[model samples]
Target: MDHDETGCQAAPEGPILCINNCGFFGSAATMNMCSKCHKDMMLKQDQAKLAASIVNGSSSSNEHESVAAAVEVQVTSVEPKSVSVEPSFSFGFGSGESSEAKPKEGPNRCTSCNKRVGLTGFNCRCGNLFCAVHRYSDKHGCPFDYRTAARDAIAKANPVVKAEKLDKI
Candidate 1:
């Protein structure tokens, strides 16, 4: 989730820093953070858990406190995480006229038919526009390069043909 330059006050950028020492896993994860922070926190937690498991095996006394302290230290060190910033919406089209509004695009036009067609997905390579009927569903629609898709489809289909050949051999 992106935010403006002002920064996201709506939520914490990092996992709600492990407040409870009595956490079931040593640190209670309150809520989700941005992807990057969440990944790091999970790694640290895994390490802490491994350490706790090992320590518990060797010592009969209360090793939980030591593990909790370690988790707290790890959590504190990950402070001041960054938030993703969303781009601002704008309506300026490249038109030089400040007063005239940009013309709205009508229905999607297919390159092959030159007519309005349903959007399956757009072609990435040559940009030869396509509708659902013209699309290859197995390849995630006609968005990818048609030539590439055709070649890939042939290659994929060859496996079945080859199995038949092997049986005859």
Candidate 2:
């Protein structure tokens, strides 16, 4: 409950303290030992195992080599893997082309006037790309039936609800 001279509060006594008494927080995976102490313990265990194997003289040179190879594999597996990423550009209005496929006239050109619209190209419902001027249905003379599409959409969204006819009670 008291603050030290450095203006930092001291850690209260609890079961969370490291069992190794190293004045650090304990981890459940490391048998309640701090990370540094856990690593040291692991190294000591590995060394003891190696020593015991050597003293027994039962393990062959081939077995030792295999163990070393396994350890090397573990070390390599722990390292982060390198990933290669290639640049992919996709315009949603294209003819379902793959990422690797290149466009014939590039995506920047407007289909109506063939003008360079760049990022300002508008996508029409008729599957044609257009510039700002020809973005509207009337401007591009779009053949996709707007009124029919709207009526169909509305019908689909709002289904008919009729009251059940009752017979004479």
Candidate 3:
């Protein structure tokens, strides 16, 4: 029969207890919060719901008011663990480029592969140089401003938009 500072009966030891007199019990939630604070939080949630209903012109007692305040309470809190990790995309050749500006790469090495791009080579719009095997934008992972043009072109030609009007006509 131990009552907390709020005059609420403290939950019996070794049990998760909710804030209200109803004493919501849970095994997963007992580690952090005692019952009293949980009750106050629930009360604030209910009050918010009531205020929302009033503002929406839906009488709280009218059996079906359109306004509703939904509050979700999670009792059990999880602690996140910290760990260091490295990205797997590293090709083991030193951490790529520090600058976006395509250096005077001498038109030799394919960015995707360190192979010598001889006669068959392509320079992607991303300004990087690559061999025929990784020439296309996708093959060499081209990060450029070209996507917006393609997206705009598709929208302009969208046949499903029946309401389209041509200004030229």
Model 2 lowest lDDT segment of ten: 70-79
Per-prediction CA RMSD (Å): 22.6, 19.1, 21.7
Q: Where is model 1 poorest over a 10-residue stretch in terms of lDDT?
A: 84-93
Question: Model 3, clash count?
Answer: 1
- The residue-level lDDT of candidate 2 at 88 comes to 22
Task: Score every model by TM-score.
Answer: 0.19, 0.38, 0.26
Model 2 agreement with the true structure over 50-90: per-residue lDDT tens digits: 55665586678896774443332212233257544332222
lDDT of 1 at 134: 51
Q: Give the winner by TM-score: 1 or 3.
A: 3
Q: Which tens-of-lDDT digit does each residue in 7-105 have in candidate 1?
A: 855554443433333332222343334444556677778666656575466633476554443332222233367544322212233555353346997
Q: Which residues of candidate 1, in runs, are more than 4 Å off?
A: 1-102, 136-169
Alpha carbon lDDT at 69, candidate 1: 36
lDDT of 2: 0.72
Each model's lDDT comes to 0.51, 0.72, 0.58
Rank by lDDT (best first): 2, 3, 1
Question: Residue 61 lDDT in model 2?
Answer: 84
Report the number of backbone clashes for model 1. 3
lDDT of 3 by residue, 53-157 (tens): 555856745433223212222335444774443211111224554323455746478878988886676777788778878887777777886879789888889
